[model samples]
Target chain A: MTAREEILSRIRGALGDTPSRPDVPRTHRQQGVHRPGTPELVRQLIDRLEDYRATVVRVAAEDDDAIGQAIADALTVRGIGQVVAPPGVPRAWTGRLADVVVDEASIDARTLDRIPAVVTGSVVAIAETGTIVLDGATVCGRRAITLVPDTHVCVVRAMHVVQTVPEGLQRVDPRRALTFVSGPSATSDIELDRVEGVHGPRTLIVVVAG
Target chain B: MSTFLGMPGVPVRGPAADTAVGHLTGDRPFPAAARDSLADTQLRRNLAHATSTIRAKRAAVVTEVPDWEALRDAGSAIKADTMARLPELLEQLEANVVARGGTVHWARDAAEANRIVTDLVRATGADEVVKVKSMATQEIGLNEALEAVGVTAHETDLAELIVQLGHDRPSHILVPAIHRGRAEIREIFALEMPGVDPSLTDEPAVLAAAARTHLRQVFLRARVAVSGANFGVAETGTLTVVESEGNGRMCLTLPETLITVMGIEKVVPSWRDLEVFLQLLPRSSTGERMNPYTSTWTGVTPGDGPQEFHLVLLDNGRTRALADDLGRTALHCIRCSACLNVCPVYERTGGHAYGSTYPGPIGAILTPLLTGLTGGDDPNDSLPYASTLCGACYDVCPVKINIPEILVQLRAEHTEAHADRHRLPTAEAAAMKAVAWSMADPARFARAGRAAALARHGIRRGKPLLPLPPPLNGWTASRDAPRPSAESFRDWWARTRGPSS
Candidate 1:
């Protein structure tokens, strides 16, 4: 028999003639107290993002121009001169920034590594866990665009914010390569002391637009 | 890999016994190994500090979730349900993965797994590969196997990189270099790492930045990456890797070909099961609300991440563990390392004493269950006796594995396996027989108890513990022997109430 067949046979034999199929209880809290995009949920999202030491700037106006201005301001504040923005990102979001490199198929990881920061729109954000899900959609770009840069400035609209991890999972497409980022890359490896800013992004600035 | 010739119920011994070999065995028994580690004051202090900090962080986050107990119950039940249907789920996983343009290979043991991975890297023509932190690869000795074939594997995670550069073994599951202080890490980096800044300070942030600078070029240039899965969803063939550092992202993305070796037990039945594990894992490990990065991929995605994906489903002793009725739940572990943080014995002796890729309460039972006790002088047999049966591990276990109960069961198996091999009863058996024979008769029990009272003289004055003679000295060497009372309870009861009631 092939290794596959042998492994399967072993599993079948180990399980015995009658395998006990225990019923799984899904009674853990599936839905939060408030709905996905409510004021309370957005506040919780900001709180969680801040807990991870991420910078959360709430754009009062949901228009493209206001979001663009906020992104520009964040970049200027951090002194990041150049950014790799994906092709599908709203032009208005980075219109004010001096140097915005539109992400494309031709850009390799080395090119992305030279860029100072990446600005992209997320698929969904979980309020409870402070996670931002980025599918390899047009707006979110390929996985390397956000990964190779020193900083990530994600734009999360209020409607994309969910209350819990279950809600976040429901919103994501399983077939697409997905990256769920909670905060800036961190490690507690040294003496178990949590020091943020590892290989991913030294700085994560989230712009939560209403 | 050597093929198994034994029948289904026949014990898997001989060649099959060595199949699961890697970092799973200790050269010495647990007591002997623990004796040396216990003397290292630095190791003890580091362990005490790290475990206590993680325990506090875990407790704080666990308390925030009102339905924590319910979540644990759900996690435990789902794993049980998955184990019951492993063969079917694995088939489903393979089909889904193939449908999505990914190839899945099944390995009966570690040697086959190492061979498959080495071949894949060779096919890529990359002499070096970047690696994510994976316990599976460590267990299989993948790095050494690759090095034998002239391929260098660069460990990208901060803790793993430290272990690699220092030429040291990982002591903790999450923080592999938990035994080393920041000063030691700085020294290693300055000495071993090429192009490292000479004035590197011992501060963690400064050290992490140095690692980022060191590995950035390697991550971009790598053609192949190897990883281990945190969970594999059988319904969609999606493999999940939960990590705090972005090195996981770099490895999962930048490489042209990605090879993941996952233990067969890591497969969950459905995608929705991740809702429970993702919630439980980050909190249980690193004591964070959520880890900084969690990457999930389903087979091969066009124009994003690695286009060629290979999944190696490993069954190194998992089937042996699954065959046992009560011992199978050790497979339910999500690799959270929560039990290690809460274990008292682990805090004292550290992970080196356990002598496996896995350690603490989980390793004590898991090592023995995966590799069955081999009668005479097997080191795996010592693992089950390494625990104090405190049940702290069970309490903190996210999947609620009864580690203490399994430890007791393994202890019984050890005794039985040895008894079958030897003609004469062992010392422990003889001692138990004497007690049972004396207790069976009331008059004889009294005589024996009165004679045992004479042992009180063995205690040195003012010293709490009584050191015993050679036969029982090994037991008392680690454990304290309390002084025997001058009079037995049975003798006192007889003298005080003779013919009264």
Candidate 2:
């Protein structure tokens, strides 16, 4: 047998027979926000996120032209010129921003090195914690898009927001890659001083599209 | 064969072995030298600032949820249940992992765990391995083990890299380099990083970029990776790792052979159990609504991730810890580090003063329990006295470990076991003994209180006279002696106002 098999056999032997079942329920109590709907949840999530020092914006959900224009306007206001987007990102979101270079997913790291911001969608949003969960799924793009860029603009639809962490975990299947971001990547390691945007995105901008 | 050239010497026993002996002899305690550490004002200020900020943030976010209490309870219960049935769940976990094409290795202690990981790396013919921030590895001293075998363990986490470069021990659980500021980090980077820019500043971005540049090469080059899990789900046979840095993702994916060393107690009964912990861990630890990076992998996929996966399930002293009914609840710790943030003693002395990977209130109770204070050096006996019995650790504990109660209990045990060797002559203990003897008769009890009042005139203007001394010096060392009143409160009250007046 292979090393994996041998290791497994040892584990099996060490563990022995299965024990009696616990009386407690396996699933946690669902304590999600009782939002009237997805839009309210998204707005609430945005408000809570903003409280954490995250920059938030509101945009149209279906108007790719407006979405692109808004992103371009935001980037221009921030004095950024280049942006990176995953391959599956809707072209409509980029159509209006001609001056902003839209680096494609297949672009090499050298080219991506020039980009200042990346816009994508989130897999889920947790209202209770004001957190956004993203995988390399639609909108949220690949993990690198959110990680490598200096600024991350994650778009969350009102419909995708959940009430609590448990609800969020249920929506995320472990088989696929997942990244759960609360605020921007931060550290307090330095003399217990909080310094934001250390290794991941220095700034996380949430675009809550209703 | 080339890997053996720069190797460090491997002791016959691993770090766990030393700890086990320490545990067995009941000898490893806080040393007298550590007493001075509690007076470090700079460390106190740093810890005060760090812990307060995280505590406030945690309280704010935690209160946002209506059922957060329920979640905390559930999380504690799940962990308790898992630990109670650890032997069986471990077997189930192994079977499920094997069925899913994953491998599991059982380590009786740290030495066994380290050997398994080192041998696994050797089998893969990898000279170097990238590492994620794993407390288990630190607990078992895996890096030292790997080094002895000529395997270079490169820490991928930014803070961990700083610790590795500085040759310093981790000072905080969540932030290993918490004791270091940006200036210190920059200095370490300049001195240790190969081809690092000379103009590096203490600016956050500059330091992070330097670290990124340094690690990017290692990430691209390493063929083997090792990690520890935050949570191990038995039902799904999965391991979960959470971090703010993307390095964990890089290390988890980039390596060809992945080895994870997890404490056996890390297991939860099922994936669904994640709900309660997912809520409790992030907020309690970093004061974030959610962790920035959470990665979960169950076995191997054909072409997607590491082709060979090995999970070393380590017991170390967990079973021994489990046998003690009152102490076993410690296993419920998700390592969220909430208790450390609120512990007054820890805030002043910092993590290094504990002399163990586990520190603060949790370490105070845990280290002695795991090591079982039977024999060994003076430090082990001293650990029980390390606490101020402030009860702050219990309040902030997400799992509600009742740290102060446990500390007192351990102190009693320490005193009882080592009664003849080092007897404490505490004034309060002597007073209590007298009171206990008098309390057997109501007449003697009444006379004792009256006599105590008559002796009150001897009390000095400001300084109170404590009846006994020496071992009680631990308390009086820093505090002003509380003066006894001119008359006992009970007698004064009775003389001034009749019982039913």
Candidate 3:
């Protein structure tokens, strides 16, 4: 018999039709927030992001000009001279940037690393965990866009912000690549001490638009 | 060699193949191994400091969550549910992964799993492959197998890199090289890694930078990457890797072909079910509200990341572990090492003392069950006795595995199986029987006490005689045994409360 058949038979032999799941009591907090843009919960999200040393920028949901201004300001403040995006990100968000290079999935991994920062729009955001999810949408670019660069600036709209991971999962396209960033690239492997900037982008900036 | 149906890998077993199992198999019983580990003050200091830091961090975060216990219960429940329905869930997972343009392989044991992976890397014809830190790969000794075939595997995780560079075994689950300090780390990098800066200090940032610079060229050029999945979601066939450094992301996304070796127990029912683990694991393992990065992919995504993906479902000793109803709950382990951090024995002796791929409370129960210590000559038989049964492991276990209860059960199993193995009645068993008989009756107990006192008369200054005799020598080997009191407590009470008084 094939290994799969033998293994499946073994599992069947081990647990012979004994019902064991009905007694699993699951009374845990499933959703910390069901609504989006609650001031207190957003503040909580900001608190978590800052705790992990990721910068957060708040903006009005529909104000493209303000979103543009926020992105430019973040890049300038960090001295990120060259930025890369997928070109599907609203031109308004890249307003007046001197060295913004927008290309959609055409850049090679080698040259992609030369850029100082990456700006993209997120598919969903989780407030409870302070996470931003990229579903490889046109605006989100490919997986390599946010990864190879040293800085990642993701724009999350209020409607896309969810209270729990489950709610956030509901919005993402499961077939596409999903990168969940809670903070900048970090590691605690060295003596279990938290040290940032290992391989992926060292700095993460989340622009939360309400 | 046929490529029609599923990847039907081979099965490996028996004592002859023990060496094929690599570090997962140990030669010495836990006691002897622990003696060596305990002798190293450096190891003791490292284990004490690292375990204490993680323990405090875990407690602080777990205490902050109002539903920590509830989450733990739900986590355990979810795992149990997954296991009960594992056969069906695994089938579903296989189907989903295949549908997403990924190949799925079934490994019956360690040797077969190594064979499948080695062949896959060979097919790619890449002489070198970068790897994400994976216990499944380590357990099977995949790197050594690859090396024998002239393929080099580079460990990319910072801790794993430290272990590989130093030619040492992993000492902790989370921090594999926790036994090494900053100074040792610097020395390893300076001696091992080519092009490392001469001025590199023991500072973590400087160390991290040195690694980043060193691994960048390799990550960019590598065509094949090997990994282990934290969770295989049956709902979407998505494999998720939760990691801090970008090494995991680099391996998963940069390579042309990606292969993941996952234990059958790592599967969950659905995407929604992922929330519980995502929340429970970070807080319980790393003591973070959320990990720095979590990368999830369903399979091939046309022009992005690895175009060819393969999922190898491993069942090395899992089916055997699943056979026992009382001991099977151990399969629910998430490999978080929370039990190890909080275990007093593990904190003192470190992971090497356990003498297995897994260590501490989990390894104590797990290694024996996996290896099947039904009788004599099993190195893992002594592991069940390594713990103090403090229940700290169970308390901190995210999935609520009752480790203490299982440890006691295994001890009983070991004793009963080996009871008649000897031709002569051993002094230890004989002494136990005598003690039991004496304690069963009041008069007999008094007589036994008198006998003990008479024997104690041979002692000098309340200490047992040097070079003590059989069975008694085991105790005296560690410390001098105190002589018995002249009058038993029972006798003293009887005389004082007698009717004549």
Best by DockQ: 1
TM-score to native of every candidate shown: 0.96, 0.81, 0.94
What tens-digit string does per-residue lDDT give for candidate 2 at B399-469?
77878887888888776666545465445557678779998996687677777666656456534465435
Against the correct fold, how does model 1 do in TM-score?
Answer: 0.96
Question: What lDDT tens digits, residue by residue, belong to model 3 across residues A1-210?
Answer: 787887776666666556376456767765664576677667777888888888899996658889989999999998877889886899998876888888755677888878889989988778777888887778998888888898999898877767776677767776788898888888887778889889988889988888
Give all candidate RMSDs, comma-separated. Answer: 2.2, 7.3, 4.0
Q: What digit string (tens of lDDT, one per residue) describes model 3 on residues B1-501?
A: 221222232222211124347566677888989889889998888788888888888888888878778878888988888888889999999999999999999987888889999999999999999999998898889999999899999999999999999998898788898888888999999999889988799999999989999999899889999999999999889999999898999999988999999999899998877777888898888888788889999978898899999999988878767767767799899989999999989888899888888888998987777777755777887899999999999989999999999999998888776776756545666888988988999789888877877777777864665567777778776776687888877677778887324
The candidate scoring highest on lDDT is 1
- Model-by-model lDDT, in order? 0.89, 0.71, 0.84
Which regions of candidate 1 are displaced past 4 Å? B1-21, B457-467, B478-480
Give Cα distance to truth, residue B239, candidate 2, Å: 1.3
Q: For model 2, what is the C-alpha lDDT against the true structure?
A: 0.71
Each candidate's DockQ? 0.65, 0.25, 0.54
Candidate 2: segments with Cα more than 4 A from true spot: A1-37, A48-57, A63-122, A135-155, A201-210, B1-31, B375-378, B420-501
Q: How does model 1 do on interface RMSD, in angstroms?
A: 2.6
lDDT over C-alpha atoms for residue A105 of model 2: 45
Off by more than 4 A, model 3: A17-19, B1-19, B424-427, B439-443, B455-462, B479-485, B489-501
Docking class of 2: acceptable
TM-score of chain A of each: 0.98, 0.82, 0.90
Error in Å for residue B17 of model 1:
5.5
